[model samples]
Target: MTSTLALDGIKAKQQKTWASGDYGAVAALIHPMAELLVQSADLSYGARVLDVAAGTGNASLAAARCGCDVLATDYVPALLDRATDRAMAERLPLSIQEADAEALPFGDGEFDAVLSVVGVMFAPHQEVAAAELARVCRPGGTVALANWAPDGFIGGLFKTIGRHVPPPPGISPPPLWGSPDRLRELLGGSFELTITPRDFVFRFASAAGLADFFKEHYGPTLKAFEALGDNGKALYDDIVALADSSNVATDGTLKVPSRYVEVVGIRR
Candidate 1:
């Protein structure tokens, strides 16, 4: 088992990496998945919902829009600040807090639904975070998520990044959350899981443009490049090539389709 201290160190680094670039630019393109997740959770009016690792409030705002009372939490306050701004602008019933995914501050059975969209999966301690997600939900409540499928574009993106700057050892990749079998192994005893594979199209003018945009505005991409130091240019070239290979657009513009799994579980 990984020591708690090392896990904490990884989490600290993750926080900095995610905060390094403007993730908002990348997140804005995935709004549809948020809506789909809210629907999958079947949240009703006045439902008490918790959005874990709710960066920029995509899931929280979506839930609030559907009449759920949402508490959006993350370890990074800067990201939470953006979520707060989004909630305020939309006049939604969403609250903000800085909380770790593995060590959630909410009470047991406190929420009717727990949601994460490309969120909680990134926690350094996967099992602990998964348990925390299940712990806070009321019996029969929903725990819905949208994770990047291991065979998808985003997964390939991370894999490419890993080749340049390998992830810390002793930690499971976040894409594992995208697997239904893995989700069952983690949460099956506590909840009945419903997993669906879906694709979300990411539009861009060109593969090179997309790569540049992500490296400049996406945290993980930026961090990977930073870690690569002088070899960062090769990483950028790899990303451009990856994006180009995944492009399904015929008109020159990019329309890359990334597969992700939508998981909706009912707590037992």
Candidate 2:
């Protein structure tokens, strides 16, 4: 039932929100997760790295700081622009390009490593994207990917919210990849797979902080609500109220939980 609804939503909004600048601000919320995934890649200085769906270059910049030659690509030009600007500001030699994950615009075996932090699952075609990642990485190169864990706090939250709002057509809620079996299914045959589970606790100083986060980061949710007509505004209000009630500290700190699946695949 959840899968039916989620896929419906994905098909409706995959083009507009998932593949656009709408996701830029949410990048910060995922930074901690990205850092962990990047570290798991075990990158060394001068490594040739490609970051797929590299929104705002968090992982790419982190790799560059370690002296890796990084190329960050995303389908959204606005995200690439922001990522490029950030690289320039930091004086990192990171290249930013606009490209799709399933059909990357690079020659075969072009990179020593490829990483996608909290990105690839959103690919309209995850299997094709996995194949592409395998295609670009030379034998013995590494491919690191991270995805959200289902049944975690964030997952529960989204599930709750999703129950209130009708999901967009054709999108199913994403599968949790925290399990090794699922990771194997996603990238098993193409590379040697290792799965790592990591948790993130988002601490917000106050309810206002949560509100500000929603205002800034929940672009797709907001857009989805708006598209729902009059019911959307009411639903948005309900969501905010729910968030407000979930505030844990009077001093303005709210701990929101998240878990991720970090899969390291050595190209075969």
Candidate 3:
């Protein structure tokens, strides 16, 4: 498959997973990091904020709560729908839009701030997405991007899965905006960048709980499993077994680890 086709396939799986609402339950997983991003933002009350790839509006909602007029955009309509519902329920002044990160629908310099938590790294073209982010922000406005650390727990999980399941032809994995040097490279020049390390731990009741959570919440892998044929099914089973065996914890709580690199860029 061509690179675009591969990305579409992955996107399709992600839409299905997020549409299931399982993602909403795991919102807490990134809560601390999200709060950090917002607090660090020091946004003004009337700021026009754009939350790109705003999955279920975790960061967008937080920004809205901070009194900013927020626009939450995502490629997946289902995820946007969920975010819209969430905004209505919470009485937040937030609008949902279907927009690609690489090609934002808004005009130039329209937003006072742009924030994405664990979102931009999934863009098929990181450079294009980064440029787009800078393009939409007014001069001196802030653009904050957060992504997982490649050497952290979540990174290890993806590495493990990638080892077992070969990617579809021509489809490279998403760019990881994890390291400080890498984040600077991807996002510098357009904006002045600040990188910080943030970490979190998820405690599951049991290994089985952790497996089920993984099966449900880890969108890409679950989608990969759904894409598999009969032979692929066997391989997926072995992979699951391997993951389960590795999920040993002394007490009942399965301690799954995670870390993030939050990059803040001020428009120059």
Candidate 4:
């Protein structure tokens, strides 16, 4: 297939993957990470904030709670529904919309800050997505991101999954966002960049429990298992093995630490 067709096919599959499962359940566990990202952004009260690929609105809600005027957007409508519900429940005045990160539905320089927490890194076209993130922010505005590092637990998990079912060729790995050098290359000329390493700890009853949780709530994991058919058990076993190896908990439970990079870019 042509490169363009390959990209189109991959993006379609990604969209479907994200839409397949109850991501909100998994996203809810990372609210602390969202809060940290907003803190790093140092958002001004009443600032206009845009959360791109805002699955279930964790960062959006964090920004809103900080008193910024927030718009939470994602390509998945079902995820937006969950975001809307969360915003309403929290009594935060935030807008939820459907938008693609590569082609954001907003005017240039429209927002004071743009935030993506484990979000935009998954965009099929990383360069276009990075450009759009820069384009939407006003001059001197901040674009903050939290992306999983390639050597982190989550990254290793993806690598393990890839061993079972490899990703499409010609597409960059999402973990590139976690590399300081890659982030600088992607955003440096248009924005001044800052990178900080951080870790998030995941606790589960056991390695098996962690695998089960992802299989049930994380779309990518769920879809991978579905695609594997009878081979899914083998993949799950690999996941459990990796989880056990990464687990830090002493009492037989799982507590895996995943490192991520916190990126801040100021529009030039």
What Cα-based lDDT does every candidate model obtain?
A: 0.91, 0.73, 0.76, 0.92
> Tens-digit lDDT track for model 3 on 1-268?
3576666776665556556536666765766777789888888899999999888888998898899999999887877787888889998888888988878999999999999988777776567788899999999999987788887766766666676566545543453678777677777888898888876666777655665676666676565556564545554555445445555567755665567777888899
Once superposed on the true structure, which residue ranges of model 1 sit more than 4 Å away at CA?
none
What would the TM-scores of all predictions be?
Answer: 0.98, 0.83, 0.86, 0.98
| Over 4 Å off, model 4 | none
Ranking by TM-score: 1, 4, 3, 2
Against the true structure, whose TM-score is highest? 1
| Residue 76 lDDT (model 3) | 78
Per-residue lDDT of 262 in model 1: 96
Give the residue spans of candidate 2 off by over 4 A.
Answer: 1-12, 18-22, 164-172, 206-208, 237-252
60-83, model 2: which lDDT tens digit per residue?
Answer: 888888799999998777788888
* lDDT of candidate 4 over 115-178, digit per residue (tens): 9999999998899999999999999999999999998988998898899989888778899889
Better of 1 and 4 by TM-score: 1
Model 3 off-target regions past 4 Å? 1-21, 169-172, 228-252
Sorted by lDDT (best first), the order is: 4, 1, 3, 2
Clashes of 1: 0
